[model samples]
Structure formats: structure tokens, C-alpha cells
Target: MPITTEKEQLVAELSDKLTRTKGAVLTTYSGLSVAQDTKLRRKLREAEVEYRVVKNTLTRIAAAKANITGLDKHLEGTTAIAISYTDPVAPAKVLSEFVKELKGKNLEIKAGIVEGKVIDANGVKSLASLPSREVLLAQLLAGMQSPIVGLVNVLHGTTRNLVCALEAIRKQKESA
Candidate 1:
């Protein structure tokens, strides 16, 4: 089949985005109201995630071009893709939160890809359950500093005991 230049461009764009993103969440927006969809888009945008209602065929082609597979089976139904370029869990986290807020209505996750690994709804939820990048980094930093902090406290303990003993001795001498 001869491809149109416009479609080629669209596919190229999608493939580029797909190739660059760390995670992609495939979802259905079937029964969401305009207000809810707008709110979702706003939230996703704030998170620096790209959300698009892409044609399944174009998505398939783009996925193939990007060397991403295993999500084609999930391309069925009213599919919209939420893609994150930096944070691998942002899209999943946002979508899962939104789904929960909506009471798991029309807005539902189908499948997802995180760091090139395909995952299902449960996997996406699990990913969402994880802390954000900043939080994880903070946790790592705390972990790295704990030993040093403990060592410093341990090193100070001898001086503390010495000072206490000196104070006690001084008090005893004054009493005598």
C-alpha cells in the first residue's frame, strides 16, 4: 500500500515520541466527559507527559518502527496513549490516580510499556504504587548518608563520655 505523506509524518512523529519516552500507558477514554478528559489532559501536561488519541493502525506502525511491541494486543478499543519522556512511572501514576478518582469508570488502563518492557494493568498499578523519582532519589540519598551519620554519632560518643566524666570529677573536687 502506498503511504500518504501526512500519515508518514504522523507515524514518524509518533515513532519519535515512542522511541524517546521511558513509559507509555495505553488507556480507554470511552465514556469520559469532556470536563473529565480536559482535566486529565491538564494533569498529564503538568506532569510533562504527552497524551494523544492515536489511531491504532498508526500506533502499530509507530510501535514497529520504534522497535516496541507487545502492546498491539492492547491497541484495541478507544485507545489513547499517555507517554512520559523522563519519568518511567509518571503516566502510570497519573492514569491510575485518575482512574481511582473516577471510580474506575470509562477511563481505564489497558496495558503499558516501562523502559521498553511491556506490562499489564496490574503492572501499571504496581509501578504507580512506587514513589516518584524525587522521592526515590531522596530515599537513596538518606540511605547513603545514614552510615556516615551513624559513624559521626559513634565518633562523638567518646568525647561526650569524656566531658561527662570531667564534669563529674570537677564537681566531686569542688564538693571535697
Candidate 2:
């Protein structure tokens, strides 16, 4: 069966969005008030996340077109999407925080995609809990440098001990 013209257009647009999006978080927003939705949108905007309320059918079509499988089960009940084209974790983190703030209201994380992998709700939460990009990069650098630093310190201490031992021997000989 052919979809209506408007529905087809919506599906096409959503497919485009999914295709171009670097990362995407699918959520359910059922019981949010207008004010709360506005607040959530603002927060997402601040984080450079693109927020969209999508129809489930259209979303499913888009997901299929994008070759993202097993997401149809998650496309139920007032589906919304937060897409992050630049920062993979931005939408996940912001949406997770917003849901937490609402005390787990009608907003529920369904699933997400990162680097072409389908992640479930728990996976999305874990991604949200991860440190920011800069923090992660810093930690990685520190971890990479620790062993080198330890090796350098060990070499220095050994060299210093050898020098001290030679000096002590020289002093004893001189005294003798």
C-alpha cells in the first residue's frame, strides 16, 4: 500500500535525517508539558543536539532505509529523536539528564545509534554516563604516558644510585 503524499514526504525527510546524522537517540515523550518540552528543547539546543518529534511509522521507515535493524520495536508510543551530528554523546547526555530531571516521566529512552551500531536503552544510558570527549581524551593521554613516565623515573633512580655508590667508593679510597 502506498502511503499518503504527506506521510511519504515525512518519511523521506526522516530518512535523510537519519542518514546524515552522526548519532541518534530515539526516545518516547508522552507526558511532557509544553513548558517541559520547551525546556528540554532548549537544553538540547545548548548542547547542539537536534531534537525532533517523529511519527513511529515514519521513523520505522527511516530506520529501515538507513539499514538500522531491530529499532522498529522501539518506535512505539510518542517517539522523539535527538540527533547529534557533531558530538555523538551530546544528545544522549542531555536527554538522559532531562529524563532524570523529570523523574522518569513520559520520556523514556528507546534506543540509539552510534557509529552504525544499534544500542539499547541501557547502552544509551551508559553512553550518557561516559565522560565528555575532552575528558576522555585527557584520560587516555595520561594513561598512555604513565608507563613511559615510570620507566624514565626508574632509569633516573638507578643512574643516581650507581653514581652515589661510585662516589662513596671514591671517598673511602681517598680516606684510605
Candidate 3:
């Protein structure tokens, strides 16, 4: 059936948002009950991600205009999109965890877009496996500081040893 005027407007708005998003994940959701669907939507909302089941044709048009090509191929089956505007990895992590919990839900990640680049299924999985922004920043800080800390400790040890040797020599000289 042709989409209604309101639906067209809604799709247009969603497409605009998708165009401006930093990352988006496309997934094929089959064998999910209505209750499961509601749960998924709730989780997505909690993560501040937008999830929608758009018509494949409209999706293709929006994707092409936004320079996201090759997404049409994965548009087959019962497709839904999760768009993330602020945090690129949020949608991926959420969807990956949801799929894991569902187990036999038959939810397959099709593809994704990150920083205007199209990525396949494996790419999405890898993206999902990435740590959050705060965690990554903390790890980076630790990595950057470790060498400096080691250098400081080494310098302190050398200085302490030299001081101890000087003290011993002074004591021996005084005794002699």
C-alpha cells in the first residue's frame, strides 16, 4: 500500500535526521513477537536512539541522497534502522546486547554507517564491541601516563641509591 501523507512526512523527517546522524545500524528483525518489539523499542528509547521500520524504497532514496550507498542490498527482509546522533556506538551496543539476550530471536544485523562510511555486518559487530567514550578516554589516559610514571619511579630509585652511597662514604671517612 502507498504511504499516507502523514507517513511520508514522518519518513522525510526521519530521513533528515538519519542524514545528519554520526552512525546508524540496520537490522533484520524476524520471529519477534509484538511484546518483544515493544521491549526493543523501549530499550532503544532508553538509549536515546531512534528506531523505525521504513519502507525499503524510501530508505534507498534517503540513503542515496545522504550519500549512504550499498545499504539497499541489506534492506531486504523485515528491516529496521537505529540511528544514533550523539554517540556513534550507542545504537550498536544496545542492539548487540538486545540480540544477545534474545538468543534465538533471529535478529540479524545487516549493515551500518559510521561517519558517513558504510560498513557491513562484521563491522557492526566490531563497532558494538567497542568501549564507550568515557571508558575509552580513561584507557587512553592510563596508556599515556604509564611511561611517564615508570620514568619517574626509575629516576627516584637512582637518586635514592646515590644518596645512600654518599652517606656510607661520609660515615666511613668520619670513622677513619
Candidate 4:
């Protein structure tokens, strides 16, 4: 079948997004109310993530063009994608939280991609469980600094001990 111009445009656009996005989560948004969808979109927007309902056929073609594999099976059934260009964890984090809030009223996670690697739903959950990039960086910095801090304290203690010993000797000499 010949592809229509509009579909070609959609494929091009989705292809671009898939290639450029740092991370993306595929979800099943069936049974979601308008209000709930709006709330989810707001939260995603605040996190700087883009959420859109996608045509599975167009997305499959786009994903192929983007060199992304292992996404075909998960594209079925009321698909929407949450894409993040900056923070890899933002989409998963927001969607997971939103799902929790809904109490399983159909906003189910399907799969996700992070840094070009495709991951399953469980993997998405684990990704969501991770701290934000900033927090992880802070933790790493603290880990890197702890040894230096400990070494400094040890050096200071050694100098203080030497000074105390010297003072003790001086006091003994004065008394003698």
C-alpha cells in the first residue's frame, strides 16, 4: 500500500523524536478519563517530558528508521509515548507515579528505552526507582569526597597528638 503524505510526515516526525529523545516510555492509556490524562500530561510537562498518543503502525516504522529494535510487540493496544530529551528517568518516574495514583485504572506501562537500550516493564520500574540524575551525581560526589575528608581528619589528629606530646614534655621539664 502507498503511504499517504500525512502518514509520511508523521513517520518523519516520530522518527526524528525517537532518534533525538534521550529516553522514552511506551504506555497503554486505555480507560483513562480526560481529567486523568490532563493531569498526567501536566506532570510530564513539568518534568520536561513530552507525552503523545501514537499510531502504532507509524511508530513501528519510525522506530525502525531510528534504528531502535525490540519495540514492535509493545506497540499494540492504545499506545502513547512519553519522551524526555534531557533527563532519562523523568518519563519513567512520572508515569510510574501516575500509575500508582490511578490505582491500576488502565494507565499501564508497556516498555521503555534508555540511552538506546530497550528495556521491559520491570526494567522501567527499576529505572523509575532510581534517584534523579542530580541526586545520583550528588551521591557520587559525596562518595568521592569521603576518603579525602577522612584523610584530612587523620592528618589533623596526628598533628594535634604531636603537639600534645610536646606540651606534656614541656610541662614535665618545668616541674622538674
lDDT for each candidate structure: 0.93, 0.89, 0.86, 0.94
Please give, for residues 1-176, the per-residue lDDT of candidate 4 as tens digits: 57999999999999999899999999999898889999999999999999999999999999999999999989888999999999889999999999999986789999999988789999999999999899999999999999999999999999999999999999999999
User: What is the Å distance of residue 134 in model 4 from its true position?
Assistant: 2.6
Error of 4 at 99 (Å): 1.0
Q: Encode model 3's per-residue lDDT on 100-170: one tens digit a residue.
A: 99883668888998987889988988999999999999999999999999999999999999999999999
Q: Write the per-residue lDDT of candidate 2 for residues 1-176, one digit (tens) a residue.
A: 57999998888888887877777899988888999999999999999989988888878887898877888888777888999888889988999999899889878999998866789999999999999999999999999999999999999999999999999999999999
Largest TM-score belongs to which candidate? 4
Best candidate according to lDDT = 4
Q: Residues 35-89, candidate 1, lDDT per residue (tens digit)? A: 9999999999999999999999999999999998797889898999999999999
Name the weakest run of 10 consecutive residues (lDDT summed) in model 1: 68-77
- lDDT of candidate 1 vs native? 0.93
List the candidates' TM-scores in order: 0.87, 0.87, 0.84, 0.93
Query: How much is the lDDT of residue 19 in candidate 3?
Result: 79
Clashes in model 3: which pairs? none
Work out candidate 2's RMSD over C-alphas. Answer: 2.1
Candidate 4 Cα deviation (angstroms), residue 153: 1.1
Per-prediction CA RMSD (Å): 2.5, 2.1, 2.7, 1.4
**Residue 22's C-alpha lDDT in candidate 1?**
96
Candidate 4 TM-score over all chains jointly: 0.93
